[model samples]
Target: MNDDQATPNPTKDRKFVEALSRGLDVLRAFSQGSVVLGNQDISRITGLPKPTVSRMTYTLTKLGYLAYSPQLEKYQLDSGVLALGYAYVSNLRVRQLAKPYLDEFARNTNTSVGLTCRDRLSMIYVENCRPAEITSLRMDVGVRLPLATTAAGRAYLAAMKEEERRHVMSSLAERHPDTWPELKQQLEESFRDYEKYGFCLSLGDWDRNVNAAGVALHLQDGTLMALTCGAPTYLVSEEKVKNQLAHQLAILARDIERLGV
Candidate 1:
């Protein structure tokens, strides 16, 4: 059924609401970090009753948005979901607006450069460019990465409105129990740096052997995206990574801003 023609506020009605909202909630319970969830776990996470969650899970599995892992008895998002997300990005202004700049950065730096945007709580890769020599780190379009532990995520977080940032921090506290303290400190420092100099850098924080730097691509519409450069530790030192790449990053940001990224 079309979204506009679907039951209106069926959540208030006892009949159609069960299959409508609960199914969507079941799909939402899975994320980049939360790839699979058992019925009980889904119930706890979504605040839906155990039986309701069970029915919703079964329904979704039948509908192809989710798959049932018999060994784990957990549900995971299927590849079919990518069709929906990719359709949105394929038509996005950011992809067209940021493409040439990313291509130029990769050519100049001879390293990987990418553009990512905030999707609720995760960072979705919209564009990527890398040198032909680097064959290990295979980043694809539409790949979702956790924002709390990525340079692009931290940069986006730092650029958000104060209230939105608070909500993100709260959700991070709840979603990531192990990395909360370190992530919080990193976020604070990055935000300060971004505000002071309009760019952010992280070294070996997201992954122990990788380094990255990023700058905000702020558009006039209040929507923000981040352009980031990522490479191995040996290739990106603290001084050169932050001081040098930051300048190039700023120029790219300006170019994107002019085009409204």
Candidate 2:
């Protein structure tokens, strides 16, 4: 059999398979900018074929994860996805522990704060506190940012265990050539610098006008997520804010760690 084909594995094979993953991916493909998608759009966004996306959409609609607009011939994410994400987030130990600290950080800094965990090659927002100025972008709960672009994602990558870090960075190298450069030496140097400082600062790496800084909030299990702060570049410039903001974020992380948050 080819590598693309499923291997015969007695130990790994399971009777209770998961359509859950594919369905969730389809739902995730619908985002803030693209609220509804036709089969072709879904196919392009998800890398799934048109026929497979059509079948999944039909099944998802039946299961209530999607709702189809007959006039537009497009599918929009239904309320069911909220319930799924809500259930997961509601039960997460990190979200529970991070909320109060995030709130405090936002209030103290008078800036927006977010907590993000690694999800595949993306960073999934778990908690956030946005001041009105920052909320203008409508960056709210359940936002996923590219791991190679955002400060929180870079911070998480910087904090990853050795083997896991190699795997994720390698995948990023393969998947995003235009965005991800082939500069291995520079990447390693940046990671080392972040490790020395305990945080990472990104300037216009994700969004051209957005400046962000983040520090890892470590868990006892050796897993870590990031506490991130972001603003428009006009408000926080690259030359002015990287050191100060990173220090502040690191302090917050230390406090949270001491408090076991």
Candidate 3:
């Protein structure tokens, strides 16, 4: 059975391990707003067999990544998962070092500033700073956005190494054959804009409620990340983003990079 719940990895070599893949798919089955899941639920989500999901879930529970509920007869992520996620955040020194700058920028601009890192074919928010008064935008840490359409994702593609970007784009195109052409054109334009302004814009392109500009940062730790700053559409215009927010985000991205240096 094919397990393509998240992004599809286009190339699989002989070193690939199916069992490990299935196990990770089982974990990926637990998504945002998903509380608990039984083997059947995971099976349907991952397209794996019920028996295989049962075996994988049992193994995961034994390893402390999952906890079983006796009354509900389902499983939920446990401490092991939290530890892994926490370790990732803790090791990213940029998250701690950049927060103050982000907060200051967000507070001054009345916009939301978010730090994101690429995960597979999407970008996941690592740190978020928003003005307390702004309540329309809801992006926070752990929120994931599509790689092809988002300002953050386009900035990531513009900044990533060519070979790595090609690999990711291949998977994206293969997965979204119908939309890839248009999205690819937009990404190319974003690249040119990134060259001129050091930032990319998605003015209601991804979410109509949001108007955002993004820029990329290359940390001293060899990590590549993206930064986005935006407000709700009603509060910001495309010209305002290009003339104001974009420059602020680009400057913040450079300052954040200097911290890692």
Candidate 4:
């Protein structure tokens, strides 16, 4: 499973560039919490050889994607990565279109609203809004959530095609083998929620005192995204999440698809 392992069989797929994949994996080793790292840290995180990691860091630094810090003896992501992230998020037409509505909804409901899409085995927030009067979930853009845990993630899975859902579930199971049975049961229940309620609910399942409801949007070009409405348990009643907010979110999603260019 290590990147240094010779049989990186996924590379056998057509047009799957192994070296590029490995380099990207190296870049991904850096996160918000992991601000600076050396070859050994990246090697340990990525399961690639130290020498390979060294070479990757050198190449990435040369390409302006990473900066070498002689003082710290580590690497930090450079402007290249920032530019890429900024450019991608800025150009998301759906996020742009949904912003006003999402902001208004958040303000009116005194909750947090987020739009997210799948990233690997998780959902990455593309846009998020919160009420100015209340501080709810502090999750922001780029925050990732487990694909089976959050209401947004469950709504996303419920919206996927059957075969694709099976593939994703298989991946999730592999990623969490021991907990798969419990999580799978939760997903089945959430799917039923989606069918009956027009949205999915995560009733403090992701945390001890959080409640959330989510609806999925399938865009004209087939881009799938999920919109989530969430708040602290004390702030939002489960009855409101199940009966009111969830359905309201579903209507908002439909409006976004119908009206957005």
Top lDDT model = 4
User: Cα deviation of 257 in candidate 1 (Å)?
Assistant: 1.8
**What overall lDDT, based on C-alpha atoms, would model 2 receive against the true structure?**
0.75
Off-target runs (Cα >4 Å) in candidate 1 are: 1-21, 30-47, 61-64, 67-80, 176-179
lDDT rank order:
4, 3, 1, 2
How many clashing pairs does model 2 include? 0
Candidate 4's displacement at residue 186, Å, is 0.5
Candidate 1, residues 1-261: lDDT per residue as tens digits? 111112235657656655676677677677525878899888877778899888888887887888999999888998667678778878888778778878888878866888888766677788899888656555778667667667788888888889878877877777667877977888899889888888887787777777788877787878788888887777777787788887788788888888854
Candidate 1 clash pair list: none
- Model 2, position 48: C-alpha lDDT score: 75
Candidate 3 backbone overlaps, count = 0
User: Model 4: per-residue lDDT, tens digit, 1-261?
Assistant: 332112335736876787888898888788525999999999988888999999999999999999999999999999999899889899999999999999999988888999998866678899999987556478878888877899999999999999888877877777678998999999999999898877999999998699999889898888998999898999998998888899889998998898754
- Cα displacement (Å) at residue 245, model 2: 1.9
Better structure of 1 and 2 per lDDT: 1
TM-score, prediction 1:
0.80
The per-residue C-alpha lDDT of model 3 at residue 62 equals 99
**Highest-scoring model, TM-score:** 4
Could you tell me how far off, in angstroms, the CA of residue 96 lies in candidate 4 after the best superposition? 1.0
TM-score (all chains, Cα) for each model: 0.80, 0.82, 0.89, 0.91
Model 3 global lDDT (CA atoms, 0 to 1): 0.85
